[model samples]
Target: MRTIMVKVKPNASEAKIISENGNELVVAVAAPAENNKNPLMRVFEL
Candidate 1:
């Protein structure tokens, strides 16, 4: 199994992840916290 580290930003207008020079990742998701949705779903969308 492989793990990629990512920083998550919840409730954004869009869902996406940006690489930061291979050292870090920035993740944004459209799903709000009130919906019982997990931000990790953003990765599945990729």
Candidate 2:
């Protein structure tokens, strides 16, 4: 398995991977941070 660093932005208009550089990524999710159980998992799913 490979390891990657993810930065999550909750409550976005859509879910997507915004930027990726090497092992780091910036992710945006539509679900609200408070309501969503696992935003990081959601990001991974996307």
Candidate 3:
């Protein structure tokens, strides 16, 4: 298994992944930070 870091940006325009470089993975989510409603489902959908 390859371990990587996920960077989530809440309340953005749309849910999307910025990039994956080195040991870091940058992503943008449409859901807000409240109630843990972040759009994490699309993270591993890549």
Q: What is the lDDT of candidate 1?
A: 0.49
lDDT of 2 by residue, 1-46 (tens): 3334454556777767777766556655576778766656433322
Candidate 1 lDDT, 1-46, residue by residue in tens: 2334443455667766654444445555455667635545323212
lDDT of each: 0.49, 0.58, 0.54
Q: Model 3 TM-score?
A: 0.36
Which stretch of 10 consecutive residues in model 2 shows the poorest summed lDDT? 37-46
- Considering every candidate listed, which one attains the maximal TM-score? 2
TM-scores, in order shown? 0.32, 0.39, 0.36
Model 3 RMSD in angstroms: 5.1
Which of 1 and 2 is ahead in lDDT? 2
Off by over 4 Å in 1: 1-10, 36-46
Who is ahead in TM-score, 1 or 3? 3
At residue 27, give the lDDT of candidate 1: 52
